[model samples]
Target chain A: MSRYLIQFAYDGGSFSGYQIQPNALTVQEELEKKLSILAQRKIEVVGSSRTDAGVHASQQFAHFDCPVPIQKDWVYRLNRMLPHALAVISIEQVADDFHARFDALSRTYHYWIVRKKTPLRRHDTYWFEAPLDLEAMNAACQILFQYIDFECFSKVKTDVFTFDCTIQKAIWTEEGDFLKFTIQANRFLRGMVRAIVGTLLEVGEGKLKPEDLHQIIQSKDRNQAGRAVPAHGLHLVEVKYK
Target chain B: MSRYLIQFAYDGGSFSGYQIQPNALTVQEELEKKLSILAQRKIEVVGSSRTDAGVHASQQFAHFDCPVPIQKDWVYRLNRMLPHALAVISIEQVADDFHARFDALSRTYHYWIVRKKTPLRRHDTYWFEAPLDLEAMNAACQILFQYIDFECFSKVKTDVFTFDCTIQKAIWTEEGDFLKFTIQANRFLRGMVRAIVGTLLEVGEGKLKPEDLHQIIQSKDRNQAGRAVPAHGLHLVEVKYK
Candidate 1:
């Protein structure tokens, strides 16, 4: 059997989530189903990230083993079978032992916020009308890299061995009427990004001081942090590998 | 009775067109249907521009006659009743004699072209991979201002009293990874903006000379013009009034 890795993008609003469930549609389920039909056999796929429902992905990776070698027309044929929301950007043959999840070095996420009522960007962006202080928000992002434990931002009941995470970069950039928050990390816990975003927004809103994030992270209490932002505004942008 | 003018926006993929017709969903029909329900009386609306199917509008206006005066909570309540793809930005009372169609002085349309497969912008932007010559396209736009009749760039079977239109502004602007064509005219013929965009793309592709547009316009024959571009990439951005 040969292992194949494919990079894809999906609109998260179309599926319940990335992982397979009993009744709801999912990205992994659709990919496995389409791949199995193409290969004429059952195929199980492993994704690098299990993004939440309504969380979009610009670049996601998955690996699967197939008895037949990679077909030249597989990407084109697979895309034709996938829905408009799910698309396979590219595919390549990888070593049999190369794991999509374990081999990933880092992952990046973006949270998009728009000011006015936008019809085109409704599904993916959060409409935030209040004035924001970007300098304060950026200052809060700096506090994230100072700590390795993000338990304050993660979901309380998640099953995880450790809450330690290395944040490589975190910054907020203003792009014409949109405010985008970008964060890159070695690893993330469930609901970590959204919770961080919501906490940072309080800083922008003048409710939480920039230095308060340090205490929140030190507290390591989920309730100590701000509320978790909506899943629709968050996106899984890139998954990096060494 | 009072005439109220509402400035709104819509994703044209949600409707067949701006006009009401048999056995088809339309923006005008939706507005009339909802307004009728809100007023508890039959309400008729007249749109400033009849946009084509699959086209989008960032800002559009429609005037409707109501038995009652403008309601304070109409905008908020109407938006709740509208679909996610449709929204009411604002509403105000206009003069009883004011005409939505005839009182409009000019209209601005934008055609967005992107060079990459943007999954987020798929519905509103045309994915064009060719290297465009903006200088050639801009030169062709300047030539448009020198002429009045645009018969060659209009649909062949359209019914209109005259084909003359006054060009106020026409130019192509590069907006960081996207090419946008903006055109404002006192009036337009059927399929005029899209046909002009398609023919200008030929100039950018080196298929047609920039000067060739002069002859094409003078031909006054629809067969002389290039094919009309897809409607999805076009947007009715503005409608000015005296």
Candidate 2:
């Protein structure tokens, strides 16, 4: 048997989510079904991140074991079989024990918001009409690196073992008519990035002071933080492996 | 009567075309229908450009005359009535003699092509996997400034009086994963820009030499030009008057 690692991208608009559901379409179900047909056997694949419905991904990784050796041109052939919204960019042979989810070093996400209505960016960006103070938003992001416990930003019903995470970088930038928030971390809990972006936007709106995030983190209370932003505006940009 | 000029943008994928047809949805039809409802009177609008189906616009203009004065906040209210694929950016009062199509000084268009498949940019860019020679394409564009007749590139059945168009600027540039061809002209024929881009790409693909364009233009024959590219990759970026 040979294990293969595949890097791909997907437009999450038409997908229910990354994981397979009983009667719904998903990224995993689509890939496994296509692979099974191509390989003449049942195939099960593992994904690195289970992104929420309507969340896009510029880069994602997956792993699957095949009973027979696959050719290098499988990447091109696989893309031809898949829908235009989902594409396989590259495929490579990996060690038999390599795991896509457990062996990742870090991940990065970007949340895009625009102040005005943009017909071109309606699906790709969150349209927030309120004026934002960029300086105040950046100030709140700086306080993120000081703490490790992020229970306040995570979903309460998640089954994760720990609420602690090491954030590598957090920054807010303005590009033309859009405001983007980018964050990288060793590991993230469910709904962490959206929750953090919503909280920082509150600071930009003058509802919460820049220093209030410190208290919110210390309280370890989910209600202490702001609301979670929408999923359509979030993008999984990178997945790193060692 | 008060003549108002409105600036807007649209994602042309959902629109059949810019002009009104018997049974098709169009940008002009949507605007006129909504404005007639808002004003409680029949409103007919004249557009700056008649963009083909699936052609986007970053900035476009239209003019309409009304008997009653409009409030300043109508810009916001009108946007609420329009679909998400179309938006009104600015509205201003103009002189009675002003015309959106005839009085324009120049118009600029951008054609985007990508060498690789990108899920995020699938709708906005044309993907062509062939290797392109940037230097050869730009050399052909420099020859555009010397000619005033482009009948070879215009649509065969167009009803325009003259095939003369002054080319102010033509340039090809590369950015990250995309190649952009930008052009400005005093006026353009029915399918001139797309035809020119198609021929330039032929130059880039080494199917045609840079010097071959001189003969193609001088031939005054539509059959001598290259194919007209797709409408989805074309964007009406700017229109200027005065």
Candidate 3:
């Protein structure tokens, strides 16, 4: 048996999510189906990130063990067989112990918000019509680094055991007409990034103070925090491994 | 009667073309249909640029005469009523003699070519797999300004009386992962911009020399030019008027 690592990108607007579902189409299901057909055997892929429906990815990694030897042109072949929204950038042999999920060093996400409505970027941006205070939002971002427990930002009734995640980097900047947020962490709980962005936006809108975030995080309750932002505006941009 | 100039943008992937057709849907048909409903009368609009099918427009202008007075908030109302692929940027009353297509001083087009395949921008850019020499392409751009007739770059079945158009600016530059071509002219023939880009790409690929364009233009034969590139990669970015 041989293990191989695959790097890919996907536009998640047409998918249900990354994980497999019984009745809905998903990124994992599509990848596994195509891989199984190519290998002439049932193949299961372990994905590095389980992005939600309507979330895009610029770079994602996965690993699978195969009984057959793979060729160098599998990237081109697999991309041809897969749907247009999913594309495999490269595939390479890896050690047997490389787990795409658990072995990942860090993950980064980007959330995009546009103040003006444009028809060209409707799917990729969240149209936030109200004026936002960027200085206040950045100040609130600084407050998030002081804690590791982000239960206030996660979705309720998830299968994960712990809500602890060590954030490596978090910053907010303006890109032309877009207000972008970038955050990196060792691991993320269900719906964590969107929830954090939604809360920060409330701070920018003057509905919440920067210090209010400390109370929200310490409360260990989802209801104490602001609402989760829409999934369409969020992107799983990068996943790093050592 | 009041003549108003309306500026808008559209993702032309969903449109057949800008002009009205008998059985197919076009940008003009959608705009007229919606405007007629809003104005409570039959409305006909003339567009500044009649972009081809699958070509995007960032800033397009149109003129329509309204019998009733329109509110200043019509931009918001028209955008809300239009489909997701179309948006109205601004609307202002113009002189009675102002025409959308006739009085335009210049028009500009932008063509995007991406060497790398990314799923997020599949619809917005042309994926040119081969290596392109930017310097060679720019050298060929300089050869275009010395010519007045671009009959070799026009569509064969067009109904234009004159093939003469003065070229103002033609340049090629790098934009992130894309090699962008921007061209401006007083007028353009059908399929002119795409053909120019295709011919320049041939020059970049080392198949044609910079001086070869002069012979093709002087030949006055459409068959002498390269093939017209895909419309999906072309965008009518700007339309200027006095």
Per-prediction interface RMSD in Å: 2.0, 1.1, 1.1
Q: State the local distance difference test value for candidate 2.
A: 0.91
The stretch of ten residues in a row with the least summed lDDT in candidate 3 chain B is: B114-123
CA lDDT of each candidate? Answer: 0.91, 0.91, 0.90
Rank list by DockQ: 3, 2, 1
Relative to the true structure, candidate 2 reaches a TM of 0.93
lDDT of each residue in B1-242, candidate 2, tens digit only: 99989899999898998999999999999999888887889999999999989999999999999888877887788788999899899989999989999889999999999777777777778878788899999999999999999999999888899999999999999998899999999998888999999999999999999999999999989899899988888999999999
Q: Candidate 1, clashing residue pairs?
A: none
Off by over 4 Å in 1: A1-7, A19-46, A62-100, A128-159, A168-177, A198-228, A240-242, B36-40, B71-73
User: For model 1, how does the per-residue alpha-carbon lDDT over B1-242 read when each residue is reduced to its tens digit?
Assistant: 88889999999988898999999999998888888898998999999999999999999999988888778888877877887678888989889899989999999999999775556777898878788899999999999999999999888888898999999999999998699999999999989999999999999999999999999999999888888999999999999988
What ranges in model 2 sit over 4 Å off?
Answer: A37-40, A214-223
Retained true contacts (fraction), each candidate:
0.42, 0.62, 0.62
Show model 3 residue runs off by greater than 4 Å.
Answer: A37-40
Ranking by TM-score: 3, 2, 1
**Tens digits of lDDT, candidate 2, A1-242:** 99999888888887988999999889999999888888899999999999988889989999999998887778878887888778888988999999999999899999999888898888779989898898999999889999999999999999999999999999999898898999999899999999999999999999999999999999989899999999989999999999
Order of models, best lDDT first: 2, 1, 3
